[model samples]
Target: MPDAPTGVSRALREAPPDRVVEAADRAIRSVLGASGTVVFVADYRINGLWPVLDSRQPDAAAHALQGPLQRCFSSQQPVRAAATDGSCQLYLPLSVWGERLGVLMVEMPEEPPESVVRRATDIAGEVALALHAADRETDRYRRARRQERLSMAAELQWELLPGRSVSHGSFQLAGQLEPAYTVGGDHFDWSLDDGRLTVTVLNGDGIGLTAALLTAVTVNAMRNARRSGGGLVEQAELASDTVYYQHRGHRHVATVLLELDCATGRAQAVDAGSPHLLRLRGSTVSRVPLEQQLPLGMFAETRYALQEFDLDPGDRLFVVSDGVWGADPSGRETYGERAMARAMRATRLQPPPEAVGTVMRELQAFHADADLRDDAVVVCLDWQGPDGRAD
Candidate 1:
């Protein structure tokens, strides 16, 4: 029989934050009676996985298990393979909610039964939860996730984000930023309260650290208002006033504030002139038009109007900053005029998480793989009805 779950939980709780992975390995080995185990975490780019090995082990090649590991991570499923010595290698996705952390590989003397596989899956989940919580207390996991050091500006923007993706009963939402290593100005945030989901996309004015600081202030102001029981208008007003006072009409943040009713699929929005909103339903894709208002901080006492719209089941909504829509390489036609719609059509069947990445890749290709001229952000949201069915 497998060891009790509390053994793993207790071990993780007692371990120092930086050493949680080591503690998790020992606890998992005891529970599964496995020969060995290794934890591989996804990098910042989500392009590859890197192993966190013990001091005694020789350095392992980062991409050695990329194919199998990626298959398991993308599918959110367990994969079992036969080893040369007749042992079994089981790869399990380590994810919490919908956010994928990495993969857990266990080598067993023999192929485990279904019951053991199920237990292993649960254990992998526990490990992921521990790592997620440990992120705040230590940089161990964060260091492992990076392929290269991030710029000071990118660091601030990244830390300000809520997460890459989130899943709820009524919808699945995911967002990604481009020029990940040196990103500036562009950022996205969201919060869920009661049955309401509020999402904000900001394209701050300026570049580098200046842009990052501008976005940071606006995001925190909005958060402060929302957390204090304020509604959408109040959130926008507070953020706008905060930015105006600091920049004095010199720098502004283009923003889109959206609030959705999960049960009814009703949405209210405020568009402050930057991110472009597109709607995809069945086989068609079109822009969601909103009255463009002066960007936040452009002037003092600028009032924002709330526009309402309804989302049907099976609808996919995408919000992208100017870096994507306005991408013009060598004075060519802008990406939004044509390329973006085609890209959206191509990703019709993809989930929001994958869709956001695909769209970003398309934007990069449009620039011939050159560094983005501006910071870019892409947010994809799929609304399933209250029944959890997508039409």
Candidate 2:
């Protein structure tokens, strides 16, 4: 049999995009002496894992997230268990950076040695990278993850995201949108360049496709500015101008734009509207107050001011949209008033990737598990500073 890495790489390179999973399965079986291999992809809502390109598993069936699979994915580690036939079943997390893709299951004839386990883990990483690359050319992976069709607005919003999570030496960041399949306007984005990180949270005006289109234009405008070596002020100004010209102040996007110096922990921000920033330092949770400016596109030639702040090495920040803070189901109290602070404290022990999801779930529970009245977004960031000491 060929070496695991070489075999997997060759298989992925040779396979058609839609058949990437099948190619990886064949390579893994040949390299690891496995009887069977199945790649399970986490669904869009992340509530279940569905087997992809596996003949034995029905396409409509999803493995309820629990037991070994859940443990492996959550911990980003591999789990081993005894199979019914006195063989071994190994579950390895398939993730890239901090994005949780799913799990890889390998059924071996006997218990795997530590060496085999390590090799399998590496192979799982390769498969994940392959899947991410293949995603650009095929819809198979996307189809496998969706439980149902997405609304037009949700489809546009989702395609605009960079990714759900990213990890770097100086920081870890993650963001999520609620009412995943139907979310219309709330969005978050980030980019890291030259020891600086730029993050933005946008809550577009209006609803449905109209709101989505507005957000898309604003986000792309900001991206164009940032890519051209523009700072936070430039990004905000360009996006504001683009929106104003398009909507003529008839619509606008409430947003927060922040830039962090990874080495010094110094930060600058532009609070254009509804998105709120909260800081968690040690045990206390407090809002990071900024001079609020008009929402983007509120008027022509609206100038924005830059506000400054400092992030300690151990600090955690949460950026939330109005849909989150203003959520008052059935005329109950809003989530931001008290529940949000408590939720932030509860998730202090988790990393940003997990923390974002936990906070979103708490929001759902706050609404008695009903669909949110409006689109909501949450973004969590942990600054490690230059020395990378923060956990």
Best by lDDT: 2
Single out the weakest 10-residue window by summed lDDT for candidate 2. Answer: 53-62
Runs off by more than 4 Å, candidate 2? 54-58
Model 2 per-residue lDDT tens digits across residues 1-391: 3377878888988999889888988888889999999899998777889888644446467888899888887788999988777899999999887688899999999999999999999899999998988988988888888888999999999999998988888899999998899999999999989889999999999988999999999999999999999999899999999999988999999999999999999999999985999999988999998999999998999899999999999899999999999999979889999999999999888888789888999999999999999999999999987888874
Clashing pairs in 2: none
For model 1, how many clashes?
A: 0
Question: Model 1: residues >4 Å from true position, as ranges?
Answer: 54-60, 64-66
Over the stretch 107-128, how does candidate 1's per-residue lDDT look in tens digits? 8999899999998888888888
Against the reference, the lDDT scores of all candidates come to 0.88, 0.91
